[model samples]
Target: MKRASLLPAGIPIGIASLAAFATAMIGGTITDLGPWYDSLIKPDFTPPRPVFPIAWTTIFALCAIAGVSAWRAAKDSRTSDTVIGLFALNGFLNILWSLMFFRMQRPDWAFWELCVLWCSIAVLIVYCGRLSRLAGLLLLPYIGWVTVAGALNWEIVRLNAPFG
Candidate 1:
């Protein structure tokens, strides 16, 4: 009986998990902490290289859970679609920032783009939280992580400027 009851939850969880996986894979592939990155003068506060994968993996997992909560709590298809759309937008912005900062070697541009990414995460927290408390609470860590990333990015920009 419990197994049958959980089927509805299984669907959304599976979908959200897949979406999270895709986002992480795509973003991780494009983010290159290569020679250019090594050449930059990072702050002493900068997280060690290993910290990034662990942090991002944990964040994506939580986001998947949050996405499931929001999807299930939504009252209408439109509401569910909206939540999914916002996540998609956030995912795109997330990947783009990596591409800009690491792959393109443009932390300056990445810094500006990070503002929009932060906004997307903020909107996700408010909008998803309205739909489901668990969803909103789950996203709290995401915002915090992004805040730390933003500070790191700001410091990188300050330390390394005039990039072509």
Candidate 2:
């Protein structure tokens, strides 16, 4: 691929990822995340509050990198179109999960949305693995975190259901 084209490939994905990150951060600031979140009954396995931002920043960076990698490798036969589609879907779903969970503060709805997010991530890993092992590996923490998040969401739903 031409050098110019390669660079631009990162632009779209990078912008989208950055936008999502910014939206989440801004939403976090504007909303009453503390009271809503703190009032809920959390699980014993929950990580520290400070850990969330760090983990999410890392995951968002990896997500951008993966998109760039996939876009750059688009011409490679190994990078199937289906993989790209799955990646795009995962990105869109990632944004939605935060909106539903944090912004809306709907634990039950968030739990269901997170289940879809988890499944999409699993499929994305398999697809990206075929294109670039590193890309797939990059998303590992994201997948792990989301899996734990799903469990937490489930527990939250069970414990704080009907109102929480």
Candidate 3:
């Protein structure tokens, strides 16, 4: 068995890498943790700020790898399309959460959007898992991070209400 056969109909790994990294870049750009964010009341469990970039970098890298694996593992074009679409949607939702919470300074609205973002991740697990178990398993950390994010968002909303 040769590895070449696996990628016969697959997309270039760079495309997957670009898609994944682009999401991170966009989201990072939208996030502004300046004085406004500093004034907010965060939960006692808030990890050191450094934890964020490290985790996101690792997650996006995993997502890129998983994207390629899922693409190549797809046995049919339909499966391939579905896999790509799911990843794309997840990226959009990921960015949207950043825009809502940090840029808009509305953790309240962001919390609602995060719920939708969470659902997208769950869907990715199902679809990506069916295409490639490795791809699906790789997303577990993403969901975990989002769960932590959800808790943070909820706490932010609770601690700082009456946003203008």
Candidate 4:
């Protein structure tokens, strides 16, 4: 038996992990749980403060795994490049949502932005699924969490409109 010739194993995982970490850090910085956020009327379903970090950490780990799996499974450089590009775009959108909601204190803006995030996730699921079923499946939890977040954002906007 001969070893298969594919892209170096660790590179994709490392790059993807680094990108995910950077995105997480940026989003975390933008997410201020200060008086402004605490003052908002959150939905009863809002998870405890501790839940956010735990949830995002788990999701980001899965994202890195999914990206690496998809890249490795790609048949050609073009496909792998596409996967990388999508993940990069998703990271940007992820940080933007945090900036809009937490930094800007505008859940209304973030709610709309969440729609774009949801679509990007959908694209990842579909395209990654095409490359690797497990990769696509891994993204399911991310989408579910984002769906909940979107609903929560919508509720916050509804509960407390006219944000300054």
Candidate 5:
């Protein structure tokens, strides 16, 4: 394997993962965001606050790993096609969720946005599975987290809807 090939294989995953990590930390940094979050009446299924960062970090890492693997597979095959497209789609949805929820402070809009994100994630998972089984597996945690986040978003919207 040429060194250049390895670079191509690894770069997308590494770059995307780092971007995800930064976003997660930045999202965590909005100091009083917690109070805003806490004030909302969440569903009983909502996990504790601390769990989110930890879970996101792990999921992002997995996504990066999967990206690298898929990239390597694609590079070897001389094309990225579906694998790369799916990864890009998933990333777009991920960032959109943050922008909708935190920046816009629109949980109602965020709730609907998450549905789009969830669907994109599902498509990514199935598409990644076609390219690499490990890549598909890497998305499982992300899908799970999004599912929970979706429910939380719904509850937040429901609770805040009347007033906001």
Candidate 6:
């Protein structure tokens, strides 16, 4: 038996990539780096400021690849639609976290939202795993990053609470 292409011809991986890029860009734009953010008391383990963009860029790229792979691998249109819906939901949660924490300057609220984000990642991993193991594997790093991010969000809230 022959293996199918990871991304079928005319499957529009470009569109998926573009959507992921847009999501990342929107999240980045919402993340403010001004006096308020600088004033927050971060934990010792917090990565250097420059590390964030690089890390997020890589993660988003992997997410796009995983999404396309899973979509292509889906055995039926219902499965493909499910993959698309899950990815769309994850993207929404991803951007919402940035808005909650950075734009609103409320790490407390962000911490709660990150819980939902983490769950979305886990769901993607599980569903994508059923479709394509490689796709699921690709999402591992994303969950790891989100784990670290959740920890950081919690610490920030702990260190600087009572937001206005």
* lDDT (0 to 1) per candidate: 0.89, 0.74, 0.88, 0.92, 0.74, 0.91
lDDT for 27 in candidate 2 is: 42
Each model's backbone clash number = 0, 0, 0, 0, 0, 0
Across 117-147, the per-residue lDDT of candidate 2 in tens digits comes to: 8999887777766667787888889899999
Per-residue lDDT tens digits for candidate 5, residues 1-164, read 53336465457666767866765665555424666656767778878878877898888888878776665666444346556577767677777778777767788887888999899988878767777789889889899889988888888787677534
Q: What TM value does model 3 have? A: 0.92
Compare the candidates by TM-score and give the number of the best one.
Answer: 4
Error of 1 at 128 (Å): 0.6
The reply for model 3, stretches above 4 Å from the true place, is 1-11
**Candidate 3 residue lDDT tens string, 37-136:** 9999999999999999999999999888888888778777777788889889989999999998888888899999999999999998888888789999
TM-score of candidate 4 on Cα atoms, chains taken together:
0.95
TM-scores for candidates 1 onward, in order: 0.93, 0.78, 0.92, 0.95, 0.80, 0.94
CA lDDT of 46 in candidate 6? 97
RMSD of 6: 2.9
Q: How are the candidates ranked when ordered by TM-score, highest leading?
A: 4, 6, 1, 3, 5, 2
lDDT of the structure predicted as candidate 2:
0.74
Q: Give the TM-score of candidate 6.
A: 0.94
Colliding residue pairs in candidate 1: none
Global CA lDDT of candidate 4, please? 0.92
Tens-digit lDDT track for model 6 on 1-164? 11234445655578789999999999989999999999989999999989999999999999989998898888877788899999999999999999999898888989999999999999999999999999999999999999999999999888888887
lDDT of 5 at 16: 67
Q: Looking at candidate 3, what is the lDDT of residue 129?
A: 87
The 10-residue segment with the lowest total lDDT in model 6 = 1-10
